[model samples]
Target: MSRLILRCFAVATLLVPVSAFAQFDIEREPINYLKGPVSDPISRLQMRLDEAEVRLTFDLKSGYLESVLKTLNVSETSQMLVFSKTSFQRNRINPRTPRAIYFNDDVYIGWCVNGDVVEVTAVDPQLGGVFYSLDQEEVDRPKFARHTDTCTLCHASSVTQGVPGHLVRSVFPDSVGNPILSTTTYRTTYQSPLKQRWGGWYVSGTHGQQRHMGNMIAKSSREPEAFDVDAGANVTDLSKLINVEPYLAPHSDIVAFLVFEHQAPAHNALTLANYQAKLALRDEEILRKMDKDPDAPRTESIQRRLDHSADLVLKHFLFVEEAPLTDRVQGVSGFAEQFAARGPHDKQGRSLRDFDLQTRIFRYPCSYLIYSAAFDGLPSELKAIVWQKLHNVLTGVDQSSTYQHLSAEDRLAILEILRDTKQNLPASWRK
Candidate 1:
């Protein structure tokens, strides 16, 4: 198991009370958004809100969702439904009216069908992920309530590497939307196998031979053995499992789930790296104040910590141990097509978003999230290491087994794609 996951389990075990979950102390660890160079989308949007530069027009004719979707450019086809009763508003969620989640590249918007608040999570170049909620009833101004204490109960746990970030889980849920705690729950990521994913979420795709824990509800039982997964295969539509009338999109797009499973951890790792860099710089300044050389080997304690954190992030960002696909998968809801269309293709019409669902997720082995703002905002010292490693690995200079799955053609294509489409690539990448 990864240290990141161990952190999540350790913290959650302490917080899960005998009857219910206890509040985690979030203010104890302050996320220094105020002190740092900030590029968080939500904070920027809030700035616009404060200046009256951007007005969210709430149409009572449509509802808060439509207005928010327009304001954020979050696609309707990006809708995903989860009924695990895991949110702050868990009481409002059930199998019939599951919470719907939608996302684009930069932000995720979540709403329970006819629920009170429209929840949103946005990325900050420095802050990783931050949570906010807008009142569905108060559509006049539609102010976002910045949540640190309440949302951090789950967001700031070890799941997010003890940082304010995002995570996804696969839980064994009963018919009433309660997760069965007796069974082992998976913190789903790119490294997680398909069969071990999507326990309480709706999935729409055709998996040739693999069986997963999605598309089915367990009866009142404590045993994972009670749940049969054969019924969960090749689920192209979810109308039989739940009422689709209340949701925005009918198909849950297995492609989208896979993308999310990969991107969430990638984002978390990037956030971790960003935070580590800031902390390192802060400590370096402290040493300078004490009349000590910050970068001197004797005083490089913080630098060593930064190096370890950078390597941890690189391990995840490089897909060192990504899960392999056993079956040929095809997605419903045109999600694959839409996702591919958004890509800034190279001269040969090649893009990182192109899918290879036969043996793996991406056509190229590298994660497209390397272009994310979090990565772009990485400290120069850490980014140098990442770029050098990327060049060596892609060029077969470092022929480790972890990246042996990448074909020569795949490497060349990825290299060309990065050179052409990705902005501000390292000079070393060309060699």
Candidate 2:
């Protein structure tokens, strides 16, 4: 087994409760239902779906649709099967066009088929339930379907030949169905996309300092050559860099906010609450030093722009918070509650709410800089307006009251800050 798989098993073993071992029961009855052996094509399809669900009960690993034949004492020739939730349509004009289906596990399963579901069945292996098809149903056009090509376009990035599924790298905890830390070339062989971009190893264009490790480790450190903007060395130039857009936008917003709040100059904040103060102070210090030494390593222009970018990010966050929740930006608490009440599968086979919360929450750190920068870079007129609004809300809260008791306007102002910070990021910052 790979190290990642081993690690998962180890973690699972440790976390499994002793009661779980004692509760294991091999004699439990298998769930069963029947559909199909139908003459009509549409009827046959619906029957297939029903049979798949029956088989899935015995192999419940969450969102995985198992084949009835695979779980039963049947030969490979047995026809029972469960189609993946996603499928592709061939472009009539282009036979070479690629198509695929993405499973909940992030595996891509490719196939071509026409028409909607027709029949369904369920079977009980433990009880030996008989197989039969339900009445035929008319095909209805599907309202939503993701193209197979879209699946391959992304999955092609981390596919392993020997592995059954695509390698998905995630920071969340892994369950039986979802592997949190799958093996990937990016981690073991190729440089980690995150590290490569953030560590400043590769400068994008000719506009910045050259301080890569090779120069730092040399006996006589020398500046690396200016980045080739035309060739695209920095992350800004690399479209394939993972999560670059979302990550950078928020990062800039946070920086911007810090610059505005603290009016300090340093990039690093002394305290979380005082981040803005520190950045603003740092900017002032840099400007002062530059006056004394014209050839200083840091340039005033860069510092000013960084501050401006930070301000813009903060403004965007505020805007997002104020906006009503659409398909995106649903609050974490609300989403979790909805997921808890959902049936076996969401509309998309996978639970949309769970996926959104898990993926988006984990990626928050990626955008911290953008958010900071947005705050710092607000236009002078807007800065005064935001600052005053914030001040009034903060002052309005009584010393005796907790944050939960704050008035709606006060809450709205804070939401505005978050929304604006999220929404106003420049096109370059978007994914």
Candidate 3:
């Protein structure tokens, strides 16, 4: 089958990487996803709670949802509503009462009406996506526990490049909120076609002429794709379709949705790069020890692995394959302004968060997540390769057709922005 499947199977049997093949055991190896020490947002919050430094107040209506959001620094306006029965609490989510997701750069919080627990996911610098659940019941102490057993079944699939990460999926859901099995489902990304996006999600925004599969339900299981997507287009309000009073926000801002589609996969790419580099380096160490040469040159196989992983991260961080927008997209929840304002701007007053809704997602076409902890936490060897690749492309040294999307102006602007904003950039970048 795939190389990832081979790696998993090899790891399962050998518990270590072989001559050319490297084992990827999540538990015993470099990436101890579940057993390793975690410094994610939720884990740190737990430490504060144990130390009596913070208290999460619970309310009768939404339990600890509001307090948790405030504590986690996840804005309420970054909310997205999904009516599909896709989550662990799928039974509680439907067209009438949907599940709400709020997120910031590093953390995502999921809540449902009358749901048993508040789902939290934190992007650990080293561990990728770490899942946790907070109980709804009010007790003397509220704790967030790692919920890996169930979460990893879907998160750590081929979709996430065989790593623990998050994703956004679109499916044709029936009236009661069950996805129609006969129809096609999509794992949405920034490169996804607009017409096929947001099938079971409530999209609240305005886009002229362009039609998406949001804010509507499949009338028939047999003819799930027969519905007119135009009816869902230009939807500025989700209150008519579902009870918005229960949720923290009234709208599922399309801008936020668009950003999420890009950010989720980018996180997965970073995590994959991190995991692959660490594994490759460990294997290299083993080889060096066998040869009894402390200064042995890295194997070609190990070097290729590092380069490939860095290339993946660079492509995503630079938004190489982002789909161009056909029409001007606008959001009602003001998430765009809020997101753009939270920036590490250069002297030119430009940030990667600046949107180009008329033609593309971001104005500069570079991902703002370049400044994030996840990106910064990448292994030095992998990060160095990524930096070099970025330098080559940005400086016009590599004029290969693969990066023809970046114009001279775009390249110059991005280079300047990174030089001013990114602290850990290579010293040569400053020159």
Candidate 4:
């Protein structure tokens, strides 16, 4: 099922040992994730609502969902539906009544039919994915409360690289929408194979001869592998499977699903990089103070941390190991056109958002999220390392095997596009 920061119910049955989780000192020091001030879109909107600077009109059916999406600038074309009971309001979610998730570059909104509240996750500049919930009650000025306790149990786990972030999962679901924990569940990403993706979700697209685990359900938990995948393949209409009148859109566009898959981990990587770099620098400063040195250069330990963090960011940013499509994929919804239209194109009119859909997700393998606030908000030291490595790879200086997927033409086009579209790029990048 699709999610913003909700726990994957497939993994919910298994209790993870505390030692297995990577602990980041998020509560104290420079990266005070809990006590820190947040500048995420939801928090900004909350402030406006508090001052009556803006108004959110409520409707009977969807409550404040439509208004919240409008106020946050989240597009309805970015909608995707999930049928699995994997969210906070699991009792209300099923194959008959799925949760509709809408998102943009910076924010994600989750709404289930007849649910109590609208779940939200906004990407903060430093804190990564900040969770919130707007009550579905009919009040003059509805409030959005920041959530940390339950949301963080999954959001800040190892799946999100020990940072507050988002993830997309694919799980085998039963008739009632509960994920069959006995079956193989995948933490789907840009790297996930098409066949292994979209389980327990409603995917509306046409991918010729390429089968995925969507728009279908498992008959018996004991025989999860006996699913008739062909029955669910290349599904264009979802009306027969479930009633679509309650949702904002009639289709849960495959293009939107693909983009969502890619965006979640990319945002996580950015968040991890930001958090790790900040924490590393803070540790270095503490060590320096203990040593009584005011002008000590950064230690190797700190540099290593920065290097590791940068690698994580670059790996996703560069689309290392992204799954290739066997055939041309098409989405019925206008998401593909609308997504490509959000372009900071070069003189050649090429954008990072431009879809490939034939062999890969993007024509230029570089992520469009490089222009995201999370990327832009990275620590200067960390960003410097990232830029240098990116330049080396794009300029053909570092032809290591990790980036072999990027052809010469691909590298050149991406480099030129970044030079034209991206701002504050390093001087070496321009050259």
Best by TM-score: 3
1-431 per-residue lDDT for model 4 (tens digits): 44422223322312333223256767876789999989999999988988999999989889999999999988888889999988989999999999999999999999999999999999998898999999999887889999997999888888776888897889999999999998799999989999899999999989998889998899888998688999998888889788999988889999999889889999988887787778677766666665578788876656777888888889998999999899999998799999999998999999999999999989998999999888999999999999999998998998999999999999999999999999999887755
**C-alpha RMSD values across all candidates:** 7.2, 25.3, 4.3, 7.7
lDDT against true structure, model 1: 0.75
How many clashing residue pairs, candidate 2?
110
What TM-score does candidate 1 reach? Answer: 0.87
Worst 10 residues of 2 by lDDT: 212-221
Off by over 4 Å in 2: 1-299, 320-431
Candidate 3 weakest ten by summed lDDT: 14-23
Off by over 4 Å in 1: 1-38, 49-54, 57-62, 285-304
Query: Which run of 10 residues does model 1 get worst, by summed lDDT?
Result: 17-26
Q: How do the residues 1-431 of candidate 1 rate in per-residue lDDT, one tens digit apiece?
A: 97567545543443332112112222323346434455666677767878888877654433478767777787787778898898888998988878888887778888887777889898887677778888878544557777767787688786777767787988888888888888788999988988889988888889888888887788657565476788888888789888887777888888889888888888877877766656555545654544445554423455565656666666776666788888888888887888888888889898888888888888876777777887887888777777876777777787878677677887778888889898888777765
Point out the higher-scoring one by TM-score: 1 or 2.
1
Report clash pairs, candidate 4: none
Q: What TM-score should be assigned to candidate 2?
A: 0.18
CA lDDT of every candidate:
0.75, 0.25, 0.87, 0.88
Q: What lDDT does model 4 reach?
A: 0.88
Residue 55, model 2: Cα distance from true site in angstroms: 21
